[model samples]
Target: MIRLPIKFLGLLLFFLLNVGSVSAQYKQTVLNKTQLLLNKENTIPLGRLDALKIAVVTPDAQKYGVFVQQLGRYADISSFGFSKYDEQTKYFNTIIVAGTEGDLSQEMLYMLRQSLINRKNIILCRFQEVGKNIPQWAPLLGGRITELAYPDFSDLAQQNMAMSIFGGLAITEGKAINRTEQIRLQYTRGEGSGLNIAKMTQKIDFIANEAVREKAAPGMVIMAVKNGQVIFEKAYGSHTYEQTVSTKITDIFDLASVSKIMGTTPVIMQLQEKGIIDLDSTMGHYLWQAKESNKANITLRSVLLHEAGFTPYIPFYRYLKPGDVQSKASTSHQTKMADNAYLVNHYYRDVMWPEMLKSAVKPIGNYVYSDISMYVMKEVAEHETATPMDEYVQQILYRPIGMKTAGYNPRTHFDKDRIIPTEHDTSFRKVLLEGYVHDQGAAMAGGVAGHAGLFSTANDLAIYGQLLLNRGEYGGMRYFKSETVDMFTSKQSKTSRRGLGFDRADPDPKKEYPSRLSNSTVFGHTGYTGTCIWIDPKHQLTFIFLSNRVHPQVSVKLYDLNVRSRVLDAIYETINEVK
Candidate 1:
């Protein structure tokens, strides 16, 4: 017998291993139109108009042919990098992929996320068929592989998994539907064919309860709202360690930077609605420059989006007490003043801040978040309303919306003992920031600047969220038209994931998932004092987490806790589909 060469046998073994790996990988492919399964067994009965329009990616052409025949008029095959447009160049509602694995790369997932950001829906079918070891940056898919052990289910399992993992929103038969447990089971029902909703519910319950048990945040109230209703509302920790000041669902907070959302932006919207202020109107149109520069051309939106180019931050307190000599604590980044100093040692009241705004050298291309923009906007808002910014907001926006606790300059409507303190001033203005505004620049502007210094409670803030969802109208009071509201909340710049003053989550959740509801329509803002508010119009969801992390001292590290995101993810998963 002729013996085969040892090297040839070794080569054959290597090829077999590679083939097996590829075959496993091949389970996830770009399905063609012919392979989509749309028969009565897999797809719900639908009229011609109701049939889903789907884009499938798979490597098996023959299987695709069979799938297309099985699922009549439901699926279309597309190349790997297909444009997200209909035959008429309009947007397509859904893209059906064979699974999360196979030909899809991190870049492709990124592109898919971009399409979703532009409001396109995505359907990842047979997702578990995709092997494990997926990249982290692929939002839904990455979370799926890491969180779920790639379970395969009958049609019911797939549908239920779609709902839970996607924040109770799922792609079914090519349509994006909100939370409803009464999902019509289109697949064969038997043991192992459907997701154990009971198990998923238990896991969700643990996380929500953990959010309350951990009690990591003090003086905080975190909640998630869907369709203007509270889905998950809980208070973790307390308002004060002493327990004298406690946090309540309706307890007021010093919204700090969040006031930008409640105080100034609403007034801007009203002005826009009244044709009083145009987004493109230049800052030079409002405030007279103390000095000269190209910043006069910056628009109102640029300031809100932090593109007006002032500076990240400055020690406005230094100008408050200039004559007093002081050394700040090393931990303070030398950002504060001596405890003994007063307003005499500073020049910020009228000079340093105004000079920086006037001397903003760059011409508005670089990203720099500045309080000066809000101050300037406040000046313009006052000029436009022929009233103070606070009064204008109260009369036209806050009062009408029933936001009793929201304000910039709180002349009288607050209790100091019940309020949270922000910082101990040691650089220039040597005083503990308490009931008054904590932002130095806003303090210099007399505690009523547009960018910061608004006090509020969660309930009042929820009303603000509801207003945006209502398209700027609430309780018959019209704050802005739906178009104007959309313009304010929609993405404004490439770099700034921000609309007028709203901050959106990174399109790819893995880079940083801001909230559980990943829908691109969601928008909100964060306060320097550990506060966040997010609104998702798609599911009508809202999440508000308020904490005084800045208490005792200011540290920016609390943002990575994963407590807020994890708790929110659990609450979203808790949503049930109505039959």
Candidate 2:
């Protein structure tokens, strides 16, 4: 027996006392409600079944470790150790037994055999069965979760088994099987969606494949919903040029500039809805830090409208002095940039913000697309809400919508492989950027910027898009009023095709921006990393295209070849087809 240190045991015992009672109650509640739903015959799925209703058993030493202590942040799960199995075996339809080869007790092995005989969902990983009492079929339940660790273990066998048993289990080829939920859009398929289903999907697939062949991107995930039904949702190709790991529908992509609309704008609108700050008021009234500079006088409306007279972009990375970039954080350099890179502390407040504040404002407002404005707006969000933009959005918006994998600083929540590679930065932080923000300015701000640095899978992001399509309401929860969504998504700028922190189709007759078929009523924003989301209230459509066109290096092939617009046109043509 590997005797755990006494210090570890003390913490473990403390956890069992404080954390065990609640876990036991939670487990029993799940046990009672779940017995009837485990079968594959129920018609009602979300009768408020707790997704967090999970039972976890770790080696005693690891109970207080990162694996268990940190797993619940990303998922709504309730998990505990092995002591309850004998008392609850009759109640459990599934269980995960995780340990090394020598750690499985004969008693645990015996229970495993019994559960296998009971036809339960059994997952055995990183361990080998011992003793003659175990069944031969038990070995077949074995597998490995090598890619997951620490905080990301919420996707462990528990989520997969939960997904399978709780309304998602399937009987295929006479054998019970569990699968990660794909095709997550709830209302989908049928004659009522009004489309030539087969032809529309075939054309969309061809467009995506051609985009890959031309290297517009290595891979892509495309999803489109019309009239509240998912018309198409599919993932194509691999994560990179090497094609080693084929992209899954659940993979998250860096939302680059799209973060302005998806991450920052919603919060601003909600603040307005609560009457915390008037949209029409000058930001100078609220930002005391910028009182002496030109930025203080710009209106919040102009900032969101991208007409705040700021420059298009500033290359802050090019001006880095010695000691500015450090391999590890120190008292003076406390901001982390990437896996090994950290930025000097207060660089934003003392250096970047001062430069932005002093930068000459163009003659009032002629409509310049600037990241500088959103950079200040992030400060405004933090200043007004007294909360970090990342945490504020997560607690107020994402967690409520079940957007499990949507947020800034994705590496903190997911494995690198789970996030698609954005680019290889030859300019600054010279590592291949995976699970890191691709935008240099945002990265310097510790990967949480108003203009960039948000990531999410197509499914989770689509929920946000669907919220706008439904006029600020989704899944029986209302995040914003109908008037609030209307004000933000509608055209709010006079000289440009910009909504409140959103992008719209150009009204000019000479330009074919976004799609030739798109009307002026649709609103969305495109990311620099080959991703976009377009929501159309007129047609009740929400389209999302996520890719990594900058994987090896920066390229505009996604636009040069008109991949997004062409693919979008096909859907419109198919939907309007006469049968």
Instruction: Give the Å shift of residue 208 in candidate 2.
Output: 1.5
The digit string of per-residue lDDT tens for model 2 on 147-263 reads 111111323323322322322222121113321221123323423444687998888888899989999999999988765556688899899989999988889999999999989
Q: Which regions of candidate 2 are displaced past 4 Å?
A: 1-184, 187-194, 329-331
Candidate 1 runs further than 4 Å off: 1-216, 322-349, 409-411, 424-432, 576-579
**lDDT values for all models:** 0.54, 0.69
Query: How does model 1 fare in lDDT?
Result: 0.54
Q: Tens digit of lDDT per residue, candidate 1, span 275-319?
A: 988878887777666215567777877887888877666665454
lDDT of 1 at 159: 42
TM-score of 1: 0.58
lDDT, model 1, position 11: 73
lDDT of 1 at 431: 67
Residue 369 in candidate 2 has what lDDT? 89
